[model samples]
Target chain A: MIASARSWVDIYLTEMRIAIQQQLQYRVANYFYMIGMIAEPVIYLVVWTTVAEQQGGAVGGLDSGELAAYYIVWTLVRNMNIVFTPFGWENRIREGTFSGELLRPMHPIHYDLGYFAGWKVVVILLWLPLAAVLSLLFHPTATITPLGVVTFAIAIWGAYLIRSLNQSSLGMVTFWTTRVGPVFDIYFTAELLLSGRLVPMSLMPDWVQQIAWLLPFQWTFGFPIEALVGGLSPEQLLGGLAMQALWIAIGAVVLRRMFSIAVRRYSAVGG
Target chain B: MRAISLFLTFLRVGALNELQYRANLAIQLLESGISVFTGLVVLALVFSQVPALNGWSQPELLAVLGVYTLVGGVIGMLIQPNMERLITDVRQGTLDYILTKPDDSQVLVSVREIRIWRVVDVILGFVIIGVALVQLQGTLGPLDAVAFVVALLLGSAMVYCFWLLLTTAAFWIVRMDEIVELFMGLYASGRWPVTIYPDWLRFGLTFLVPVAFAVTIPAEALTGRLTPELLAGAAAFALALLLVTRWFWRVGLRRYAGASA
Candidate 1:
């Protein structure tokens, strides 16, 4: 068991190294993608900041400073939310590349996790200079407690895992139908609204907040941002992680079940 | 006269090709519906917190959104698909076939591909504007209506020029998928009036990308915020951009050595 566990570690490490090297070579392309993504939260920040200043310096209990912090931290969480998407799955199946992935000894999810985790290192590094510029422009303020920092570090990885698992399940749908754009659109729109990608959960209508609380969307986006900037208490911080683990468990089961079902339907000959 | 006929011919062919996929209309409807709903939700959320953003009321902002959707629909339906194909052709060296055609290359490349179902957005944008007008008490004057149309046309031209400039970057850059992302991101800022952004950002949206002209000026026309001076400036800038884009495309074309060579 010890030997097997060690081998798994080695596999993850080597795959991650491959990912880091491959991604670094495409720095300009990756930065272009990241810059495009940064536009989203920046737009949200500007709108809310405008509203807050107009409303005598507060909106939904968040001042412009706090809103700035919420959205600045938002950039990092959004980066973490990037994962192998259903579109990738569509390409793999259409090109008959999934057959190669299936022939591998380990589950393909391990490769995705290791690879994207490595990509996150590059994304985070690229994110720092962008974050500094945003801070200089937006004047974001945050009181980062030690516990909050620790929780944020862990929760971002948790956020990454939960999103990857969930999206992998969504990718499985591609095996059944190639024309899944509408389905993916619906999934993304839901995540955009419910996941605090659009605004802080507090700014949402009460019923929307209640719904987000039950769903896994907030765990991947809202919880991490709030853990850092919202100054959540110890219990709330740890509890969010616990909820993330639960969702991760559910997502893994759904994905594994989906993989089995999808593989049975996936009869594409190798490329 | 020839250019008009050329565009109509390609338009008909593109429409007929897409019409075969009857289900895409439904898919487009679903996606457009979701998008419009999301836009309204965001508007509602913003207005609920404050009566107006900056100086504009809820209805005024809705008009801005309508213009944004309308402009985006027009681009997606016509401009975007053609530009994207141009980029792909440049990369694959198939643009040689386009160059060999008798028609003007610029006009030919601009009108080649159309996604017909995006008319859904174009129509919805008008409906949203209609609704916003209903909520506002004042009637749109005859002059305002004419100005709106002029501004809308000018805005579209500016956006087309901007896209041509960006797509022309493919002559050097090669992989232009990221340009689409960059455009989409910057274009999204038009949902709010460019005036709401900081001066630096607003400047970028105006001169750097021309999204301000695309979505905002027509919106300003409807909302009674457009000054003649602004319209004049937009027209002058657009004219300059057209001349520059024409020159730039020609220069880029000179650099293009097709696959045969």
Candidate 2:
């Protein structure tokens, strides 16, 4: 079992290398894409800063500079947590490219994982310079306690797993549906609302905040963001981690069932 | 007169091509419906927190949202689909076929692709704007109504030129799609009042991206807040951009033909 695990890791790393190399060839477009990614967060940061100032230098326990830090961290975490699974899988399914993936010895999830790893490396490298520029411009203030740092580390990893599994499961639904663009659009709309991408959850209505807490969207983005900037109790950190694991398990089960059914349907349809 | 007739003919052909996919109309309706709902709900949530956002009341903001939906629908219905196809055509060398056409290549390329279903968003926008006007107890005088129409036309012209210029960049840059996506990212911020944003961002939306002129300025007319200077500025900007984009389009065509030959 250990030897098999090692081999799987080696294969994943190799796949990641190829994906990275392919992405590197489009370096110019990739830089522009990075700028596009930062634009949304910057817009939100400026608006929230304005809101904070209007409310006399703070909104929901966060000052303007703290809000800046929160968004900067939010930007980093969002970039890290992003998984391009749904559209890629749906396109593959529609174009009959999934057959090639199915013919491979490993599960298709491995390729997605490798692709995500490669993309994350690119994002991280791109993020450093952009984040540095934003920091120089905005002067975001962050006070990271040791405990907060540790929790943030765990939360970021948990957030990534949750996002990957959730998106992959959504992608697997392409077997049953012809058009997944609407589904992806709706999912993005939900994330924008509930994941604290547009605004901090505390600033949102009470009902929205309550709804966000129950869903995996908050765990994937908002919770980690809040934990990073605002101090979280150990118990709350543990609860957040537990919630993340629960959602991850749910996503995994859904993905496995959906993949199995999709494969059966594919064989039946002879595609 | 001849160009007008030719443009209408191409539009008819485009309409017929879109009619073949009737299901896409339903998809477009569903997508636009969700988008409008999300926008209204976010607005509702925001107004619930603050009674007035940057001195604009709820109804006023709803009018802005309506304008945003209408302009967005118009673009999706005509401009975006064509420009998107233009990019793909340029990349694949199929734009040569367009260049060979007897009619104006730019007109043909610009009007070739239409998603007819996007009219639903435009209709929905007008309905919402009407409802918001009633809610606000605002009377639309003939002059105000005319001003609104003029602003809408000017806004549409500006957006089309902006899209044309951006797509023309494909002549120089191989992957201009990222730039288009950046426009989309920037455009999403137009849902809120530009006054709420900082000056730099406001400038970006107004002059750089032209979202403010597209959505906000028209809604401002409806709400009786649009200054004459702003309207005139929007008109002048639209005209200038139209001319500039036309020139750029010609230059891009020349470059494309030169490179291919």
Candidate 3:
């Protein structure tokens, strides 16, 4: 088991190095992509702060400083948690890209995971300076403690795990259908609404908040953001961490089962 | 005249190609419905706490959202799909076919493909605008109606020119679609009034990307906030950008022809 795990790690590093090299060729494209990533959280910050200001300096329990803090942290949490494998998986499967991946000893997810790892490194490198500039511009107020920071780190990592696994499972369904874009559209809408991408959960209706808590989208984005902005009670933090852990475990099992079935189908069909 | 004929012919062919997969229409309707619903919900959530945002009431903001949806639909249905195909064709050297054709290559590329199902967004936009107008009865005037039309037309022209100029960069750069995505990312700020953003961001939205002109300016017209100077500015900017993009496209074509030679 130890030897097998070591080999897998070696393969993942090799794949990540290759992916990073390929990504470097499209440096211009990546810079443009960052504009979208940075703009989304900024737009939300502007909208919410405007609402807050109109409501006499606080709305939904967040003053302008707190709102700014939440969205700025939100920028990092969002970038850390994004996984785009599902968007391309269907095409890869259809165009025989998966065939070469299948010939390898490792699971195909490892290949995508490596690519995502490299992508995250590249994006974070480009985005960190921008984040600093934004922080200076926004004057975000935070009660950031060391413990809170540690908890946030753990929660965001867990969030990435859950998100990646869930998205991979969604992609795995492409093995059966060609119409996965609509499914992703629905999922995107859910993320937009439930994940506090547009507004704070406190501002949303109670029922929407209830639904958000039930789903993993909020944990992937909102919980870590809120944690860093530092208004969460200890009990809430523990519950959120537990929920994220639960979702990660559930996602792993679900993804493993789906990949097994998908692989079986792919091989049976001569893929 | 020939350009119009070519555009219509491409529109028919594109419609037929999409008609082969009728299920997409239903899927698009579902997706558009969900987006429209989400927009309304977000508006409701915000307005629940406050009556107005930066002097624009909820109804006025809804009007803004309506214009945003409408313009976004037109871009998706007509502008974006064709521009994307143009970029791909350029990369693959399939653009030779269009160059050999008798009609203007720019017109042909600009109207090549249409995503028919995005009409759902257009219809949804109109319905939202209608509802908002009903709620805002008597608040809007005849001059406001004229101003909205003028702003919408100018805004659409500016947005189209901006996209064309960005995509025209494909002649020099291998991956120019990133710039297109950047424009789209900046365009999302149009979901709110441009007045709410910081001056720097507002300037970026207005002058750098033109999202303010495309969505918010029209909404401002409907809300009776359209200044004569701004409307004149929009007309001038739109016309100037149209000419600039045309010149840029010609430069790109020359570069392409030279590179191919």
Candidate 4:
């Protein structure tokens, strides 16, 4: 079993290297993508900072400094958790390349995860210095404790797993329908509101905050960042981590079933 | 007259093509509604704390949001679809068919593809603006109304020219769709008043991506905050960009044809 696990790791590392090389060839596109990744957070940061200032320095228990910290962390968490699969899934299925994925001994999700890991390494290498510069300009304040740091690290990986697996499931839905684009639009809208991508969930309407707690979206991006920014209690962190694990497990099961069904359909249809 | 007729014909074709999939209209409305709802929710969350944002009250900011949505819809409906089609056509060498057409190729390319369901955003935008205007009826004057219309028209024109210029770059860059995404990233900053941003960011939004002209100036006109000098500047910028993009489009076409030959 240990040897098998080592071989799987070896395969993923090789795939990661190849994916990194492929992504680097499109380095210009990567830079443009970097602009987009940073822009949305920066825009919201300015808006929230303005609000905090106008309200006499604090809104919803967060000062301008805290809001800055929240949004910057939000940016990093988003980069870590985002999956690019849903965007290209339709094209792949329609163009018949999905059959190639089906023919492989390994599941396609592993390849996607490897590619995602590679792409994020590139993004972090580019994004961190820029984030540091932004932190200097924005003056974000985070009360980073050892506990918060440890929880954040674990929660972030869980967030990545939850997001990637959930999106892979969504992408697999393209096997049956071409309307996955609209599905993504709806998903993004929900994430923007419920996941605290646009605002601190604590500042959201009470009902929304309640609903967000039950949903996986917050666990994927919001909870980790909010925890790191030092608002959540130990109980809350434990609950959030439990929820993330549950969602990740659910997502993996759902995606595995979806891949089996989709591949069967593909073969039946002579794909 | 011919150009208008051709545009109308293309619109009809697009509408008919989409009519086959009636479900898409519903989906489009749902997505657009969700985005609009999310925007309003964010605005409410911010305003729940503060009474005003940079001297603009919630109602005034609502008007700005309305302008942002309306402009975004128009771009998505008209400019973006056509530009995206042009990029794809350029890539697939299908642009040759557009060039061989009897009418002007530029006009054909600009009106080629339309997502008619985006009219929902345009209508929603108007409704929001109307509601906001009624709330602030006492403050607005006729000049403000006229300026709003003028700014909206000029803003749409500038955005079209800007997008066309970006699409024109497809002649040189194979993967220039990122340029459109870059445009959107900058344009997202237009969700707020431009003056509130830092000096450098403000300048970049104003001249680099022209988001100020496309969104903020129109909102400013409605709020009676638009200066005559700024209006003049926007008008001059629109006219200049129109001329420059037309010339640029011709250059791109020449390069495309030469390379193909």
Candidate 5:
């Protein structure tokens, strides 16, 4: 088992290296894409900072600097949790590429997970410079306590798993529907509203906040940002971690079942 | 006269192709409705926290939303689909067919694809604007209504010219989807007043992309904030861009044909 695990790790690293090199060839375009991502968060930060300043130095417990901190952390957490798996699955299903994957020795999910991890590593590295620029401009104010740091580390992994599994499941549904583009659109809209990407979940309406807390969206982005910047209580941090674990387990089970069903359906259709 | 006939021919073809998938109309409406609902909800959430956004009250913002939906619909219906098709044709060497046509190739390429379902967005935009007007308890007089229509026409012209210029660049650069994505990113900012953005972003929207004229100017007209200078400026810019893009399209076509030959 240990030897097999070592081999898998080696394979993953090799894939990561190849992906990184492939991305490096388009380094200029990737730089602009990173700029675009960073621009959205910065735009919101400036807007909220202006609002907070206009409201006499605080809006929803966030001063201008605090708002900056929140948004910068929000940008990092969002980058960390970014899952390119949905597009992968969607394109593969559309182009009948999944049949080729099914013929491979390994489960398709393993290759997808590896690809996701590889792409994320590249994204995070690309984001580092932008994050630094934002930090210099905004002077984000956040205390990274030891506990908060540890929770953030764990939360990053948990967020990745939840996001990857959930989006993959959505992608798997393409086996049944041709118009799954709308499904992805709805998913994106929901995430924009609920994931604290557009605004802080705490600042949204009471009902929206309540709904956001019940779903995995907040755990994917909001909780980690809050924990890193606002410093969550021990109980809250533990609870968030627990919820993230729960969602990951649920997502894993759903993904497994959906994959099996989709494969069966694909085979039945002679794909 | 020739352009009109060509446009009509393209329209007929587009309609016939789209009519075959009648169910798509319902699906398109559903997708557009969900998008409009999300826009309203986001506006509602933002305004719930603050009564006004940059001197524009909720009703005024709603008018802005209406303008956004309308302009987005116009782009989706005609400009985006054609530009996308133009890009694919350029890539696949099929734009030669358009070039060989008896009429102007640019005109043919620009009107070849139409998404008929996007009329829903335009209709919904009018409905939302009407609702916002009722909420404000304000009457749009003849002059204001005419100004609004004029601004809307100018905005549409400006957007079309801008799209033409962008797609023309695809003749030289193969991967122009990034440019489209950049436009979408900037277009989202049109949901609010341009004045709300910082000076740099405001300039980028106005001069760089002209999204300011596309959505905000028409909303300004509806909200009785239209200035004569801004109106004249939009008209002049639109006409200028239309001429410039025509020239640019010709230049691009020459380059494309030269490269292929």
Candidate 6:
């Protein structure tokens, strides 16, 4: 068990290093992708700010500056939400790549987890300048506390784990059907509405906020953004991390069960 | 005349090829339906907070969303598929095949591929517009209908030119997939009126990307917000962009080395 634990750390580090190198080489493409994503939050910021200005500088209890803060941090959280897509799984299974992956000593999910975690290092690095630019343009006011900051840092990684587990589980659906677009699209639509990706959940209707509370989506986007944008209190800040941990635990169990079943269906024809 | 024939021929072929996958139509319908649902939900969220968003009512914004869907559908069906192929052909040097064709390479490349199922969004867009027009207090006048059509055509032309110009850059920039991501992100901004955006972003959407022309202008025409000056300016800008794209395509072509080279 001790030896296996050591090996797992070694494997993860090696995989993450490889990912960092590979992602660095594709930095220009990554930057283009990041720039593209920036538009979403900026558009939201502009619209909400305009709305706030119209409604006596506040709407849904958030001022224009707070809205700016919410959306500016949104760019980072959105990047965190990026995962190995189900479409990728469809391609992997169809192209026979999954066969090669299955032959490896490790489970394929670990590969995605470690590699994307390293890519997150690159993503965060690339995000700084973009965030600076957004800060300059939008003037986001973050009263981020030390405790809040700590919670946010941990919650983001927890968010990453929960999302990766869920998405990989979803990706397993491709084993059954290649036409996963409809399924994936429905999931994305749900995530968009429930997650703070579209708008802060607080701004949503009371029932919508209640729905978001029950789901894992908010722990990924809303909680993380709210953490840094200084929305959560001390208890809520810590509570959000606990919620993320609960979701991660649930997600792992679900993914493990689904993967076990799904792998049986994978005939691995491409190899 | 030759270009028209070439476009129609390819359109038919593309439609027939895609027709075999009838399930995709359902998928496309669900996709567009989901999007329209979210669009309305966002509108509801906004309107629930305030009666109007910076002067535009909920129905007017729906008109914008309708036009956005229509223009997005047209681009997906016609422009994007071709432009994406152009990017791949550039990288692989397969553009030589299209270049050697007797027809103009630009016209040939522009019309070769169409995702016929994207018509789902076009029809859905018209439905939304119909619903919005019904909800709206004032009826759309005949003159406004003509103006809306004109603006929509010009807007589509501008979008086509914008796409062609971006695809043309593939000759210089080797990796171009991000261009699509970038376009989609910017194009999504058209869901709201350009007028509502900060001036810098509005300028970016209008001149940098021409999304303002694609969605907002047509919505404006329908909502009785179109000024003659604005429509005329859009016409001139579209013409100018077309000429610039044509010129840029030639310049980019000069850089193409083809596979044999």
Measured over all alpha carbons after superposition, the RMSD of each candidate to the real structure, in angstroms, is 1.7, 2.5, 2.4, 2.8, 2.8, 1.4
- Models ranked on lDDT: 1, 6, 3, 4, 2, 5
Clashing pairs in 6: none
Report, to 2 decimal places, the DockQ of model 4.
Answer: 0.60
Best by TM-score: 6
Tens digits of per-residue lDDT, candidate 3, B143-254, equal 8889998898899888889888888988988677776668778887888889999999888888878999999999888877889999999999998999999999999998
- Candidate 3 wrongly placed segments (more than 4 Å): A231-239, A267-271, B139-143, B257-261
Docking category of candidate 1: medium
Best by lDDT: 1
| Tens digit per residue, CA lDDT, model 4, A53-129 | 77788877889899889988877798888775686788777777777777788888888888888877777776787
- Which portion of correct inter-chain contacts appears in model 6? 0.71
lDDT score for candidate 4 against the true structure = 0.84
**Candidate 6 residue runs with Cα over 4 Å from true position:** none
Docking class of 2: medium
**Between 2 and 3, whose lDDT is larger?**
3
The DockQ values of the predictions, listed in order, are 0.72, 0.50, 0.71, 0.60, 0.34, 0.77
Residue-pair clashes per candidate = 0, 0, 0, 0, 0, 0
List TM-scores for all candidates, in order: 0.96, 0.93, 0.94, 0.90, 0.91, 0.97
Query: Per-residue lDDT tens digits of candidate 3, residues A107-160?
Result: 777777777777777777777887899999898998886667777978877887
Sorted on TM-score, highest at the top, how do the candidates line up? Answer: 6, 1, 3, 2, 5, 4
lDDT value for model 1: 0.91
Sorted on DockQ, highest at the top, how do the candidates line up?
Answer: 6, 1, 3, 4, 2, 5
Candidate 2 regions exceeding 4 Å error are A267-271, B257-261
